[model samples]
Target: MFRNARLSLFLPFLVCVCANGAALAQSLPQPASQNGISYITGGVGEDEVQAFRAAAPGYNLRMTFASKTGSYLSDIDVTITSGAGRSVLSVRTEGPFLFVRLPAGRYQIGAQTRHITETRKIQVPAHGGADLRFYWEDPDRHGVMRVCKSCPDTARP
Candidate 1:
């Protein structure tokens, strides 16, 4: 009887803690699905970056966007196509990080910003994830576009 009373007393506190945790998780950015592919995009702030890092393990593809100078970037239009030429996911990212869960296969990722588009081909392993980075040239302070010297021939506009 005493043990039952102890568990009863602890149950309400456990419930409250679990409820608060669920609420907090709900308030964070949630994954969206398209064509059976699930993805989440956002890393605008430190807390959000941490959240994305914590969730990265569950995703099979992780992408990061930045400028040639290494500053993080956002507002990129992204599309992922399967090796069989089927469109898997297409969305405009609101932040610098994109995490996707994909089957083991080859894929093409296209990212566009400031009227410049770059494409990359990647193979997702069966047991682990693939990480891809897309870099764009930073516009001049006067807002004029400049050539990216270090960009590959394919990435050049």
Candidate 2:
């Protein structure tokens, strides 16, 4: 009787948890196709990120965008080209993750943000997938001069 009572108490909680997880997964962005290439991009929140990670294995090419300091980046313009230089897929990512179903071959990926672009070449295996990460230097940490109003500037020879 004790075991049956415990099982009954746990079942409803399990069901609710499973239902909520399913609903969250369903809320993720749907896969899209362009020029016969299928892809999905989005990972704006924890739930969406988890959903993307769960779906990633089904894709042949998985990409992630971030800064050198490890902050996630979005609104990246992504372009993938075949080894022969033919454009296969081009789209702007809505979040930090982009998953693509591509044929087994060599491809070049270009991700652009804030007018700066980074390129990478990758190979997709015949059976599994490839993961690519693109990291950009944080703008605030580089190329910007900080000035102190109260400190006198020393002239350099």
Candidate 3:
């Protein structure tokens, strides 16, 4: 009888803990699927940034877009194609950053915003990953648009 009472009390506490954990997990960013590709694209909030950082290494391609003035850009369309020119994944970034997982190989990445469209060729190694930065300069300013495959990460705004 005493053991039964103990379990009954402990069960309530365990239920509460499990319920809280579920809520916390829901609050974190989750991956999205499109065109048979599963990717997570967000950097708007602290939670999203943390989620990207934690998952980026597992992905072969990590990307971010910005203006020549160093302002982050969003709502950009990104496309990834294999070395043979077959489209692998196409996604639109909701924030400045986009993270994607692909089979280890060579790919051409293309990013397009209202201001400019840029393309880059990159090789995904057998392990680890790479970062790419697309600088979508303002056309009015006559600045050159460029993509930096090895650019350093700037301070998160």
lDDT scores of the candidates, listed in order: 0.87, 0.90, 0.78
Ten-residue segment with the worst summed lDDT in candidate 3? 137-146
Of 1 and 2, the candidate ranking higher by lDDT: 2
Residue 103 deviation, candidate 1, in Å?
0.8
TM-scores, one per candidate: 0.74, 0.85, 0.68
Q: What are the clashing pairs of model 1?
A: none
Per residue, candidate 1 scores C-alpha lDDT tens digits across 1-157 of 9999999999999999888666546545889999989999988887677678778899989999999888899999999999999999999998999999999999999999988899999999999899999988764332554488675555335
Estimate candidate 2's alpha-carbon lDDT, on a 0 to 1 scale.
Answer: 0.90
Which residue pairs collide in model 2, if any? none
When summed lDDT is taken over every stretch of 10 residues in candidate 1, the lowest stretch is 137-146
- In the range 1-157, model 3's lDDT, one tens digit per residue, is 9999999999999999888666545544577776666677768776566656666776777898888888777899999998998888888888988887777888999899884789999998878888999997653445433368586534323
Q: State, as a TM-score between 0 and 1, how close model 3 is to the true structure.
A: 0.68
Cα error, residue 78 of model 3, in Å, equals: 0.7
TM-score-better candidate, 1 vs 2: 2
lDDT ranking, high to low: 2, 1, 3
Q: How high is the lDDT of residue 109 in model 3?
A: 93
Could you say which candidate leads in TM-score? 2
